[model samples]
Target: MANHKSALKRNRQAAVRNARNSHIRSTMRTFVKQVRTAVATGDQAAANEALGRAVPYIDKAATKGIIHKATASRKISRLAKLVNGMA
Candidate 1:
């Protein structure tokens, strides 16, 4: 437990940030999973749509420092490739 006023404030801020980041991270994972599910279902249109939605979330996550830029690029690339390679 933080005893000083500044330490307490910092703890509170950390809690808030943790909550917010958790939400963003979970939502990002959900979107990515949606893309993967669509791909696995072999629905090209749905996969493309899901990828469209997921890509921005991933980009935003990267921009916000939630994910690395290269990781974001790789994720987008793999998902796009799966969608594009679909017959």
Candidate 2:
């Protein structure tokens, strides 16, 4: 428990940020899963479409500091490879 006013405010801010970050992370995972699901179906067009939609969300999450930039690049790279390989 935080006794000081500043500490209490910090706790509140942290809680809010935690919730927001969790939501963003969950949404990012959903998008990534969509891309993977599309890829697994072996439909090139659908996979490509999903990848296209997913990349921006992944990048945005990285830029927002929810995920690391290299992690975002790796995810995009892997998904792109999967989509391209379907060709």
Q: What's the TM-score of every candidate structure?
A: 0.96, 0.95
Question: Taking the tens digit of each residue's C-alpha lDDT, what string does model 2 give over 1-87?
Answer: 999999999999999999999998999999889989988888888888888889999999999999999999999999898889887
Cα-based lDDT at residue 42, candidate 2 = 82
Q: CA lDDT of each candidate?
A: 0.92, 0.92
Which digits, one per residue and each the tens of the lDDT, describe model 1 over residues 1-87?
Answer: 989999999999999989988888899999999999998888888998999999999999899888899999999999888889997
Looking at candidate 1, the ten consecutive residues that score lowest on lDDT are 78-87
lDDT of 1 at 35: 92
- Candidate 2: where are CA atoms >4 Å away? none
Give me the runs in candidate 1 sitting further than 4 Å from their true place: none
Position 4, candidate 1: lDDT:
100
Residue 11, candidate 2: Cα error in Å is: 0.7
